[model samples]
Target: MTYLEKWFDFNRRQKEIESLLEETIAQQSEQSLTLKEFYLLYYLDLAQEKSLRQIDLPDKLHLSPSAVSRMVARLEAKKLWST
Candidate 1:
């Protein structure tokens, strides 16, 4: 009920959800995906025309612009190789 208690509860639930998501992704995907990668796809899927600018991804993914660029490059490589 207290602020500290509420914060702790929120944090605990977030961790639980992340764990469940990670487990499910591992079980379902042919190629292993990190949590951030999964989140990137999820965000794109929800975006207009299923597209988003790299500049917007850093705030959404809590990563730097360079990190987003690297991640996008890696994902693109994986897509090319998978096909």
Candidate 2:
């Protein structure tokens, strides 16, 4: 109930949730996608037309533009996603 205790509790829960999500994503996607990639696809699926500008992905996925571009390229290479 103290501030430090609350902070630690919050961190613990966050880690647990993140771990669970990673496990679920791995199982469901058959390890074909990383958590970030899964999130990218999820964001695109939620877009108005299932598309978003390359520049917009950095903010959505909290990655640098270059990182987003690289990830997109990898997905495209794998034939799993495209612009």
Candidate 3:
């Protein structure tokens, strides 16, 4: 396959995977968190210190601090866990 074809295929597969993950999260989690929230949890899980700060999340997830704060707020609103 050519470069263009490869890029298109990769994008297609990424979208499909994203869709499947959304579906799985909806089915599995009672809280029904967004993909960003899941990534935040996963990143926190990987941290050696296990101490998550709002400032640290932006660097870990490549999101703005405000965006990370919003995700944390959403999760807290659901009462999923403390920040």
Question: lDDT for every model?
Answer: 0.85, 0.86, 0.83
lDDT of 1: 0.85
lDDT of 1 by residue, 39-70 (tens): 88888889897668878999999999999888
Per residue, candidate 3 scores C-alpha lDDT tens digits across 1-83 of 99999999999999999889988988999878777788888877777887677788898778998888888888888886585
**Model 2: residues >4 Å from true position, as ranges?**
none
Name the weakest run of 10 consecutive residues (lDDT summed) in model 3: 45-54
Ranking of all candidate structures by their lDDT, best first: 2, 1, 3
Residue 27, model 2: Cα distance from true site in angstroms: 1.0
Q: Any idea how many clashes model 2 has?
A: 0
What TM-score do all the candidates reach, one by one?
Answer: 0.81, 0.81, 0.81
Task: Tell me the tens digit of each residue's lDDT in model 2 across 1-83.
Answer: 89999999999999898788888887877447778888888888898978788888998889999999999998898787877
Off by over 4 Å in 3: none
